[model samples]
Target: MRQDTLWVHREFRQLWAGQTVSQFGTYVGQTVLPLLAATSLGPRPSRWGS
Candidate 1:
């Protein structure tokens, strides 16, 4: 397999920046999703003793 050396090239900075922004948005979504799931679970769903 060939490794993409785009990381060493200055021209790829825009691509990297866009990827970084997208990844950060995904990270925020993942953090909030667990809380959303907890809220939607039914009355006796205290599995972790919360």
Candidate 2:
């Protein structure tokens, strides 16, 4: 019987790495975009509840 593991596959490794980078970029954008927008727009007391 021959056993094969995904860790031994080059294509799988590349795919996994690309997915990881994409996820990290998405996470960074999600976290940073809001902060960037808030900083650029400044604070308005009237919009606090709405």
Candidate 3:
């Protein structure tokens, strides 16, 4: 029982690590693209839709 639980725990940790990395990359892209758009075009007020 303990070994099975440990295996599941390890699997969750691996999934969490991969998700964290991907989320971080996505956030970086989210920020950079807006900056690039404004810089090339002009300083424009921004609004985010929910």
- The TM-scores of all predictions, comma-separated, are 0.43, 0.61, 0.48
> Model 1: which residue pairs collide?
none
lDDT digits (tens) for residues 1-50 of candidate 2:
23477888789889999999999999889998888999999987885576
Candidate that would win on TM-score: 2
Report, for every candidate in turn, its global Cα lDDT versus the true structure: 0.79, 0.87, 0.82
Per-candidate RMSD, Å: 8.6, 5.1, 8.4
TM-score computed on alpha carbons, candidate 3: 0.48
Which ranking of candidates, highest TM-score first?
2, 3, 1
- C-alpha-based local distance difference test score of model 2: 0.87
Please give the ranking of all candidate structures by lDDT, highest first, separated by commas.
Answer: 2, 3, 1
| Regions of candidate 2 where Cα sits further than 4 Å from its true position | 1-3, 36-50
Q: Judged by lDDT relative to the true structure, which candidate is superior, 2 or 3? A: 2
lDDT of 3 by residue, 1-50 (tens): 47666446877889889999999999879998888887999965668734
Best prediction by lDDT: 2
